[model samples]
Target: MKTFKSNVELVFNNLNSEKPSRNTIGILAIKERFETALPRSIPLNGYSLESHQKNEYSRWLKINTVATKFKNYKAVYISLKHPDRAPGDITAAEMRFVANIADHYSGGLVRTSHTQNLLLPLVHNSNLVSLWRELSSTNLSAANIDTMQDIICCPGFEFCSLANTTSIPIAHEIQNLFTDPDELQALGNIQIKISGCMNACGHHHIGHIGILGVDKKGEEWFQITLGGRADEKLQLGKRLGPAVDRASITSTVEVIIRHYLSERIDQQEHFLTTLDRIGIDSFKEAVYG
Candidate 1:
């Protein structure tokens, strides 16, 4: 029987091979190594591991394999906001720290999300509480997951030549505005995505409230879109009105949110659903008027 150490060695050897046999073979070899290194006793189907059970992990494969089962060795997610700029900037030391965390807690595996956050998907459940404390010390934790704070932003004028405005600062401003956790919770699951240009690398087209930066006569102007979604019920948001100056971006968002709050039938009604029911005309009036 191949020991876990030997299995890992074999996997690495195959990966490092100068002339790999075939892609499928390489994949199978790696999968075999993972399976051998972490064997599951119970069938993944209908056998739910307490640690693996979370609303966040629902969309991911629900298999209780050795790799997926975290009760004995749990996993956790950590989000780094504005991962591309400023405070979001990760230094080499921080990268090493993250690597160390994965090695010490999550068996040397790290995952990145489309939202640009790093995920430690296999940390031991026993170490979760302490792990959070450890991660918090290094400013690493999924603090903004499933909340409006988990903003998706693109590289704007700061780095991208195609960008018309600086998205990171705007994103920071929006995130800072809702510092009160309780108030943020009351706001519900709102998604605010920003794109530096019409390229939509930030996926602003699919955000519930999308902001696209446009250049008007060499000045930065932003166009707002309402009711867009990237979820199961995917739909493109409609344009609110004419572009607003960069200075009015935050205030414009505030106005839209205020309108949604005042007119929503109930607290449970989501912004998109409310907009769908009432139509975008009223939101347009609120923004323009």
Candidate 2:
């Protein structure tokens, strides 16, 4: 497979070989040509690895689910969960099902969120239960929207050319660790964002628990950040000490969580608030120690 650099070179070469069209090719035309000529595996962004076929289906599904109305529609929101790494990948069959629900219940309207989840806006109160049941059957419903298990992760070395390590698997492991609903509820609302590199495509800088992947002498290492939040009161997370190995990433997170649990004033107080009150040194010591 050719790299993005090579693909650019190919575009220039092809442009040079062809007769000048008004002395320059249109930007859209150039983009189209480059896309057609390049291999599908070439990573352009986090969504580069996503299947186009699935994306098209998702578009159709979202377009059809707009302005749906039922009683108490104002109070209901339908959230569609996309797995880590592979965001917005609803199958054609699944899309049809969701679209049918939207058409029947919602005024055939759906909204795609920046968090990579789909929202069925204004779902009627009467249809909420049926909608959720239908969505649950297909396993497309989001369990924890603003909770800890609702993780945000970037496409790491598996797809991005700029990535230093694999992030998706780590995200999956972290999610698995919080499988028990009670345990998750105890932890309260926590945002964990993982990026394969310092570019912060996963919005790690604004996560309550931010993990940035780095390369240390060809080995994968992760740097942890604490106290960041992307909500109403936004703040950048503070970096803990040095980076840790991939194997210890999950354990390190556990230590941080444990430290918070022990140190927190109450369950109502969020992890960020606790970190702010106690400071980063305490969490750093817990992780490194």
Candidate 3:
């Protein structure tokens, strides 16, 4: 007594034509059938399952840096985040340095992270110390991956025509407040994303702390948000309150950070975890008061 569409809905494990939370309705509808009808072919190229052995140099080199080991090689994260430099900016000389490193240590293979950092994906474990030393020599060995200073920012009014304010100075000001490496490590993976406009080129929507610039009666104002995440479990941040003046934005951020430090259960507890436990209410009180 039912139509063809009614039976199709039953195939997707739903009585109604409602979509899945994680995937599109079209994907859910066609995935199983599409895979079942796909042609299988052998890959022309072959690879080894053999893994590389652990080496001594990688141990020390990986202590502060994210030299993640794998079956074939170790992947090293090269931080571009420096206090004086713009969040994602790298000089021509630094680019050449990284290129040389890639050729020498990573088999000429390198990768860029979504967060605007570089990664040497095919680094040999034995070459890690040499790599680290060379990086440190040129001040390219910034180890602040996933820390507070590892900011994701958009080129605001400086470069973009659609911006509400300048973002580079704001980022630098915030970075200056947290210079102690020990303190940075303790903060533990709180991302700060800043957008010049609503286009969200900086991915501000999903930062642990999101800052957006807005034009207010010919003046620049910033709006802050909390609890965003850009990961496997992606989430958008909630607005903190009304936009604050440019001068007060950095101080407001500091208050929020101090509040998290005060409320965290332990040093190892991540900022996101602390936010989850204590809730954004604590941050609200700290920033507003």
Candidate 4:
């Protein structure tokens, strides 16, 4: 149970192995120590305790455990029970499970995706209950992706080194604006990615509707991109000509969708396919009109 001043030091020590027998054991020693030191509780809502700021890396053994547990969950809960409408904040009890496991197993290494979701990195092949207990504690243990609202967005002004306007608020606006769960489900596999800058930190490069903010001489503007992905079939989005002012972003996005709906060959045409067939130029003309 040796505590290093920095988690990175802990990781390096485990990997390098100062002790002979512990060489194979690696960071498992740290994890075992951490587990003993922490108290256990059932999570009220699924929230991740792992913080992803390069604090530490997980040992192979712990990663295996976490990964294994993930596959066994019946369902992963995306949101937690909160007093307000904000959906994903889990309770403190759940927070402890995430923190203890994340800290001990991975040296508290956590990674947040562009979508504002946290990843536990590795889970192992073990009893489903421990996995369920870990996830259930945080309210993150859910098993449905078919109808889930997988929205991708950037921070905009929040914590970003560069940003002119707020992008998070807009994302929340769209999420709240879309009232019908069935409508979202029917849309089926739509990816909405927003960015505060042209650097595309929010992974606008891979979203169906990629929103990028541009500096028009001095005023803030936005560029629209269509048909992009990073799947096995990776492709970059084509930008429509010219950028829109800050106030026009929401309407412009909706207008682009309207164009897609009006010109789509069929209900089966997704936003990207529709963009491909019509092309970005056509969409630009239609949207700007």
Instruction: Name the candidate that leads on lDDT.
Output: 3
lDDT of each: 0.73, 0.71, 0.78, 0.56
Question: Best-fitting candidate, measured by TM-score?
Answer: 3
lDDT of 3 by residue, 1-289 (tens): 4788766666656434475533355567787676522111223234222223122223325433453445435678888787778887889988998898887777677788888888877665555556766786888777678888989999999899999988888888888889886677667778999998899998888999999999999889999999899789789998988899998999999998899888888998888898888888878888886
Q: Comparing candidate 1 with candidate 4, which one achieves the higher TM-score?
A: 1
By lDDT, rank the candidates, best first. 3, 1, 2, 4
lDDT of 1 by residue, 1-289 (tens): 5698887776678777876646648677787777534322222234333563343233222211124453476545566663334434567987899898877676777877787767777655455555555665776653566456678888798889999988988888887777664566677878889999989988898989999999999999999998889889999988999999989998888888889889999889998888989889999999898
Least lDDT summed over 10 consecutive residues: which range in candidate 2? 36-45
Whichever of 2 and 4 has more lDDT, that candidate is 2
**Candidates in descending TM-score order:** 3, 1, 2, 4
In candidate 1, the residue pairs with backbone N, CA or C atoms under 3 Å apart (3 or more residues apart, or in different chains) clash, namely 74-123, 74-124, 74-125, 75-123
Give per-residue CA lDDT, model 4, range 1-289, as digits (tens): 3454666576566677666344447546666777522222333345333554112112212221222233432221223311122323446775676676666333354554444444555433232235444554544643223222445666677667688656666556555434354455445556667788877777777777777877767687877777777778798777776777878877777677667778888777777777778788888788775
The C-alpha TM-scores of every prediction are: 0.74, 0.71, 0.77, 0.56
